[model samples]
Target: MKILLLLLTVSVVMAQAQAPHIDSSYSDGQIQAFLKDGFERNDRLLQAKAYYLLAAREQNGGINNEYTITYLQKSHELFAASRDAYHLHRAKLALALSYVDQKTFDQAFDLQREALTYFEQRNDLFMATHAAASLANTYKLMGNLPQERVYLERCETNNKLLKDNILSLAILNSKVVNFQRQRQYDQALSAAHQLLTIARASKKTNFEIAGLFFEGILHQFKGQYQTAIGKLFDCLSLISNPNLSPEAMQCYLHLSQCYEALHDYPHAYQYSQRYGQASHAILNNQRQTALQRQTLRFDAEGKRRQIANLEKEKREAEQTALWQRTITIGIGIAAFVLFCALFSVLYFHRQKTRSDQIIENQKEEIKQKEINELRQELTLQNVQAIVTGQETERERIAKDLHDSLGGMLSTVRLRFDALKTGQPTHAYEQALDMLDNTIREVRHIAHNLQPDALLQFGLTAAINDLVNRTHSPATPDINFQTYGQEFALTPTQSLTIFRIIQELLYNAIKHAKASEILVQLNWQTPSLMILVEDDGVGYDTTQIQTGMGTKNIQTRVAYLNAHLEVQSVPDEGTTVVVTVGV
Candidate 1:
């Protein structure tokens, strides 16, 4: 009975000690007690997260890097279990920044790019912008100004629409520094002013301080020694020491530049020494971290050998598995071939009928092209006749203007000059208004003769203006829409598209008396498709002999190496679709 009681008591104590921990029990004492027992455990993931949370709180501004890095490294190791792209990206970004803060610029730059690639592939623009900003800082620290500018521009491009106010202003500030580095005083000062404006407009403290420091640095670069010193002093007074790393480093460097230029040897030497000390400390920290990495790498190498041996054994086992999979796939392929052989009998019968239709289609296309060429010849002749008639009409108008309006305008101007210089007469004003109206009318006629705006502005804008002006208030509705990316085209291509739309719309409104029109330009697969649709009297396409308008369109389409399709009904509507490689 005594032995039984002792055994029972020991078993109860062991069971109590092995009790599972219940997370989120809302008991701080229990958590502290649990942590006090051991910092490490069998569950690496749990231990890593715990150490991470603790190290984050214990960093206290990175005063003790030994403890901080140890925890970060452990957290990094356990992150492999997550094996997610975003998690890896986050860990790599954090490690890179830590490297940057420690002044390990080369390694920081390399790792930052790796993080950036993952963000870019996922189209996570916000994180990409942040990564680019960090990359810019790393490049600048390494004295690679051009590379730094490239990264800053990327940051700006990504955040242009996001309106991450602080980041946007920082990008501008970085560009100003780049300009100053190149000794572009006027441009640099302008950029600096722009940065200050952006930062103030954003109403962010960090951005505002960044702007002010950069503004002062601009003055220092411009040889305004005393002004630069005062501004730098103002910046220093404005920010607390804890918020001082980036700006303070800049201040020291710029002041050293200013003092050395002004021949203040002692002050220059003192600042140079200060810079050396700060830089040396940063470098020493990096060296220690590198040594730690090297030690980890040596340890990892031994682990890698062990892993290789295990992998060899695993691979040997996998070979037989792979062979079995291959055999299974071979059987699937053989079965697929049998099914295909049975399918081919029906497929061949269908293909024979399709081949006949394809040949007929080709013949029809060739005939259409020949017909189009003949119609274009006739349209060219018509255009020549129209031009000749217009010129004669214009000559008649010019002769009238020279003989009639010229004399009247000369007489009126002479009479007006007879009056006092500042005197106004209602009669005179009325006569002037009359003359202005006539001049405007004449200009309108000339514009109808030849449109310069159509030539200067793009095809779409020109067509839109034409539709607005020509469409009567009581006339049928005209809807115009566009899609795909717009880019600069050669003047001739623009003119051709404009002319085609004008001719098509004119034919629809005048000949067909169309009640409605829909003009659409869009990307259809790899080519651009322009469709003009109207509801009006439609002709049988069987009467395929091309008219003048049809000929002009066909000519333009040929010039563009495009395809055109026309579908029409007797009373429903006519739709014209043209596809061009654009």
Candidate 2:
């Protein structure tokens, strides 16, 4: 009995491992119709198969596992009652998978063993290999390394017997994972390399990527930071499916750690941030998907109830018509007229209900849009706060240098001049000149940190001063213009605008190599507009890499609830326009 149980358990595991992929192209309505047709035909086998397919579809759609379990149970019953051992085993295997999902490991193990026995009796080496692999995974999950190793070896041996290199490669991949878990890096690396070679030769992109990921992990464990980074990046470039999010998340996290170990704090921080954002996005997407699936299931259930009620009403009408037929002609005419009136009333009520439903749906859509807008607003506000904090810090630093450091330097120069009373020597003149240059350089640095003109004279004068400073015979000819009525703005708004203009000018001069630049600030009654144009060799905006300057500009613009437009064509001038409600 124990041997039989073990065999059954194996069969169940294999069945789950070999579950067919659900084709998402088919609509839920079509699947339901197919199932209904099978049931109406009273073909038990067909009904069982249909139910199994439905379960698979539900599983793939990420619907509640209980729904899948219900379908699988029905399929299993039908197959068992029909005494179709082969199909019954398949049903059992599917049921085991559902049980596994529900964390009923004992039941799953029992079903898997049964499935294995069935496959072995039929001399099905491929399925037997799949069963062994599943068993290995189960053991791994249970933390029974010895048992896991035994099954993994069995899986590989069976794959070899079947003469399937792809199956063998899969087993090898699993072994690599097991080896990694055991901290046997050498074995893991060896297996990963073999898997990669086979996967590449077979043109299996997914397996090849997986192989690359394993290689990266092995290298990371060996403290080969550079090699690991390259391998991990390669894996990331090849991953397109959201299902591989966990792998991608690991890559990002490990890359962050590797960079940190190498004392590259900036790269480390960047990767860590990427990992956090990716993880949040993945979780959000999963939550939304699950909610959508639940909504769809509820809708389907409501439709089914409506259909059942309609059928019930139709049956009653048929019976009433039969009774009416037996009545006299006069009564029959009256009955027919009464029926027409009742039908009209029912139709009118249905139409009214449908209209109400439509209105409700529209309301829900509008509410969802409002919620999304609020979320975006909150995100922008957070970014604005960060930018504000950074600017405030810069201002503080500038103030310190201007007041404390500048004052001390000036006092030092005064003392030096007072001490040099006697000799008008060459050394004294050179020392005076050096001291003057140092003071000028310090002032320039302080001004750049938080421009004094921007704080004292507001946005227009600051922009004008900036234009004049950037204007040189060797540099581009920058033109500044103002239009509309000049209006007052809060200091924060003025500062943000000034910084944006500064970045734009810097980009034009340094990157674009412009010969001519125009800066315009227009303040109307309720709005403010700024435009910066440069006659320079532009770039492909789509391919433009967003640097710190661009990011800062984006943050400030979002904070101001503004619109920004940039038009750039290769070999032509670039124009950037920003409009904000005052």
Q: How well is each residue in 397-453 modelled by candidate 1, as lDDT tens digits?
A: 755665566557656667766773667677767877787667656555455444557
Candidate with the greatest lDDT versus the true structure: 2
Model 2 TM-score on a 0 to 1 scale: 0.46
Runs of candidate 2 exceeding 4 Å displacement: 1-41, 240-246, 300-582
Taking the tens digit of each residue's C-alpha lDDT, what string does model 2 give over 1-582?
Answer: 111113323322212212222222344555555555554555566657667767766665666467678888988998887788877877777787678667788988998888888888899876665566666766777777778789888776776666766676677777888889899999999999998999899988877888999999899999998999999999898889633387788888989998998999999999998889889888988898879988878875764565355446646766777677757667878999999898998999999999999999999999999999999988987887897898889889888888999898999999988889786688898998999989987887788779888878878999998888767798888989999877889988888888889999988988888889999988887999999999899989999999988988888898888999999999998999999898
lDDT of each: 0.67, 0.79
Among all windows of 10 consecutive residues in model 1, the one with the lowest summed lDDT is: 1-10
TM-score of each: 0.36, 0.46
Candidate 1, position 382, lDDT: 66
